[model samples]
Target: MACILRGLIRLSGLDKCINLVELNLAGNQISKIEGLEATLQLRRLILTSNKISAIEGISHLSRLEGLWLQDNRLASLESLALPQLAQLPALRSLYLQNLDRLAPNAVCRTPGYKAAVLAALPNLTNLDGERSPAALNYAELAAEYDAFRANPVPPKQWVVPDVAPWLAGVSQEVPMGGGPGEVALQQRHAKLLPLRFGAAPCVSGQVVKVIDECEMLVRVLGEEIAKFGRQAEARKSSAVAS
Candidate 1:
């Protein structure tokens, strides 16, 4: 562990260390991972608590097994590729959490971060020096479920019903035939049903399971209706304010 207050600003002057197997450069001011291409026999690399943002270089380390890169400035793992951890076959152990040295990287704070990492690097036997089989398994399952259904929705104009009649209760029946925008409103909601259910897609199997899915569907439908009512109320308020 190097001094946290003062550390190397750059990684250099290791051209001669060709046979270096393990390199520990924790708690440094180094902003980049560079100047280690000649270390062909490199195995273990520790680089915790540095200013490094994007993960680059070190694609030549074919024999690498352990990698420590906690407390860095890495943003998102989605943007990294070409020579990513997946390309490294021998890598088994990885450390990417900060304790007392400095703050953890931004990727660590992302939702399903561990799942993303494990999904990208399936061979990783250890993560952050430990393993929780239950959590990892759930993450993997969640990642798989969202992979295909996760579609980017485009901004489209939607015609929502004036909900006042919808909320007028059973005493007053809503018109059997809506006046003008009813067809467009129905069509719009038809298209949006899939988008709303994408998060909690239906599961098929036993009778009880299908019943549970139906229950969830009813609950989501109720919530969506309530949300539309609220949106209509908000629009009315905004119009009055103007």
Candidate 2:
């Protein structure tokens, strides 16, 4: 352990010796995995917490089989190439955690990093304490669904028939059938009609006028209805002719 820490003290360790295996240099101030390639027989390398910004040195450890590098500042694993580990034919497990620290605020900004990490460690069937990737936090996702179910929608009021009948009359007349300008106006009135007809079934109103004045609304509303009636007659006549 001391030798490993010494090696990481200034990004240099175990260069003089050989025949070493199972080294752990976790929780140090080291910002990268430098040196230690001297340990040709090394199998397990655990560098859980440090300042590892990159994972390029992994390619040098041909004998390395198991690795754990969680809680680091690694922004990306795209530059890393660990083909030598796979050459060992002994590599089985690789742990990668704390990736949330890579760019906790902007994960979507870096998509290639996730792909590179998976590609570099192909034989790694067991990852991040899981015997398989299926051992992830499914319960947390279920909890989110439960929270969404508990949320309530806003309340709405019911519409009266007296108000809707008047509105529908307007929709069928000048605004809807009289000309193109009235088409938009008719659709707007149709939408409001549902509320007037108690479709909301929550609240009720005594008097429902299209707007402030009932007399002007009634007159224009009738004209719209008459126009739509004429279009309907024309359509019926065409159908009969056909």
Candidate 3:
């Protein structure tokens, strides 16, 4: 059965659809080719108008007859070699049209591109909607493949500096007790202390009213503390009696 879907980042939950023969996911935000490892019966696979940067993880589709990957962000054919196109025994037709990034490269621009792809995958009879030419020599294709593989592209490297010592020095100044900022913040909070009854201390009125409100807040806090102390004493006396 054929399944036409779109706007999927990855193929995570489609493992149960093992019987699916054809799958089309045109115009999606998918970056990597993956999550279809269990679809062994898949023949026709289309992934057009997406953000796929490399061609990986499709070698597992042994039964894939036709593959379409048009208008993607693939930079080169290096990713195809890693998966080994020769591993796909049933691949016949392959489409890689409108690859803006790869089109600029000399390897992709020349007429030898078809020959290169044919050399890469001997089983491929059609590429980019064109049938393989009958007069194409196998010896020449092998030599081309050999020349292509002779100069290997180097993998990119990343170097990260150790900033742990610098971070440690800064952290030492702001230990568990906190730094000067924390002390200043505490003093500010004390000035605008909250009342026990879930209300901010009234400090916006006349000076006399503000002073009265502060005294009232102090009295309420003292009363609450005394009441808590009495309750604790009562609980202790009851425990002794029991």
Candidate 4:
């Protein structure tokens, strides 16, 4: 049975079909290859026109013979998870062409592309719809590829301004008994202050306002209770005298 273009984000709930074979999940949003570890009988698997970025999590499909992955977002051959594919002894045919995100001069576009793939998967008899020929001299190419993988250039770091010192300056301005100008200044700019700098600039004033409001409400309630008690006692005394 084939399931194509189902708009599935994940390959869940398919593990129950242990005997199922030939699953086709083409033209979907499946980004990862997973949830098919139990389908040991799966021979042909097609995942075309999807949002797949990496090629991991398919080592369990040991019986898979044919695999198709075309018109997806594969950026480079390194994302192919070649080491895992080597474990699939039955994998003879592989389709990896017309990848939307792969560059024109990408490693997959070079002459060594086929050689690298063949070197990685020695059992592959067909690749990208072409019949594999006699083994090519892929030693030098594989060595270079391995070296590049071993020592890739580190990614650049992003530097952002420190917000601690700026927050300290703002806190120092709010006195224990600040004047109305200071309070007004804080209130006016409190909302506009950039909170992304790892400090809650408006919290101090908000906390103070909340405490003051609660105290005022308690005082008002207490006064009302006292007034009610006095009126009740006066009415009882008046009734007893009459």
Per-model lDDT: 0.68, 0.58, 0.68, 0.72
Candidate 2 per-residue lDDT, tens place, 1-242, comes to: 22355345445747865777777787677776767778777788877676666665666667777877776665544323355545556667765563333312122136654445446656666655445434344335557777888985667878765544444444433322235554455455554555655546322111222332465778889999999999999999999999
Q: Please estimate how well model 4 matches the true structure, expressed as its whole-model Cα lDDT.
A: 0.72
lDDT of 3 by residue, 11-38 (tens): 5677888998998998888888888977
Q: Which ten residues in a row have the lowest lDDT in candidate 1?
A: 167-176
Task: Write down the worst ten-residue block by lDDT for model 4.
Answer: 98-107
Error of 4 at 174 (Å): 99
Put the candidates in lDDT order, highest first.
4, 1, 3, 2
TM-score of each: 0.50, 0.45, 0.50, 0.50
Q: Please give, for residues 97-211, the per-residue lDDT of candidate 1 as tens digits.
A: 7433145677877788776777788777877755543245544565676774686466698998665543232222212234444444444444333333346633212222344
**C-alpha RMSD in Å of predicted model 4 compared with the true structure:** 18.8
Model 4 residue 18 CA deviation in Å: 0.5
Residue ranges of candidate 3 with Cα displaced over 4 Å: 98-107, 133-242
